[model samples]
Target: MSAEPLVADHAHEVSDHGHDPHATTTGLSHIKLAMWVFLGSECLLFGGLISTYLLYKTRGNGRTLPTDVFDIPFTSVSSFVLLMSSLTMVLALSAVSRGEAEAGRTWLLATALLGGVFVGGQVYEFTAFVREGVAFTTNPASSAFFTLTGFHGVHVSLGIVMLMSLFVASVKGKLTQRNAETVEIVGLYWHFVDIVWIFIFTVIYLIPAD
Candidate 1:
């Protein structure tokens, strides 16, 4: 019967519909769309690399062919490490969703460290290959192999940088529960890159050449 109570009840009803004037846009949707666009472009870039690899798979000289030089066990372990990083990435997103900022930051840092390990493995592998007479200019196979894997390594390094920045921002209170959606979007991109490696590893290391 009171005017003030009537207005308060109407205000509560509107708030339930999420019709607040101060409502912030959930940026996850835009971030996801941007990521998709980026990945689409990356597909073309990687498609070129893969085509080159196939074109050169059988053209190497007396140097180590893929089957000859691929250390399957070592690469398999590295592949698993990269895959586990994806799991850590998802855990980071989950932590942010649960408003556990510390846990989220921890997982993000773990993911970056794992990524660094993967990159280090790649560097060692490439160095060993070079020492074994697989110079980039020695043959098409060497060139293609180095080019494809090197490109992927660069991407992984960039991802690690982003993850570190995210973790630091979280530490400084720049990234907060309110930005959980942003964290989820970054995790989505990181996971996509990891999955792409599955196909890359299969083609580059597992499949037999004709």
Candidate 2:
């Protein structure tokens, strides 16, 4: 009945029942789970955009259709550049996983540069379209096309920003193997963006317009 004995008994009971609060029951990090959910939502968004583009692609009246204006060879080159960025992204993640911060930063910068190149090509294409009177208001097809592709460009630009931020973090000694999951998450996003472009290129560019 002594106070010291009661306190010691409570301490033992608590120690026996305690668990690690930071441990995940599913064996997956919360950040990764959240990223998967976000990617799922993005899939729905891109799906709707692609469907809209397909639905309205034939609605242009006396306006420039995709067949008339699409520069397939140029776009193919840009697509290849973006595709290569995915490779660099994987390399970045691998370097980070191995605690090679300098190499990871280099690969991240490479990926960002490739993404920038792709965006530059998109800008050029958009400029040429406007110059040729294929403005967003030209027709339904033009509107849908611009919206779909523009959204994708925005995603790529955001991805580039993230890559550059990661590079800076690596340079500052903030990124390491301990937090390599961050790089993996960003790589997931970058790969998703590239895959979406593949679909867009095939459905909007490679396929013939009716």
Could you say which candidate leads in TM-score?
A: 2
Clashes of each: 0, 0
Please give the distance, in angstroms, between residue 133's alpha carbon in candidate 1 and its true position after superposition. 0.9
Scored by CA lDDT, what does every candidate get?
0.82, 0.88
Error of 1 at 160 (Å): 0.1
Tens-place lDDT digits, model 2, residues 107-191: 9999999999999999999999888878899999899999999999999999999999998889889998977888999999999
What is the TM-score of each predicted model, taking all chains together? 0.84, 0.89
lDDT of 1 by residue, 43-99 (tens): 889889989998988887876765567778889999999999999999999998898
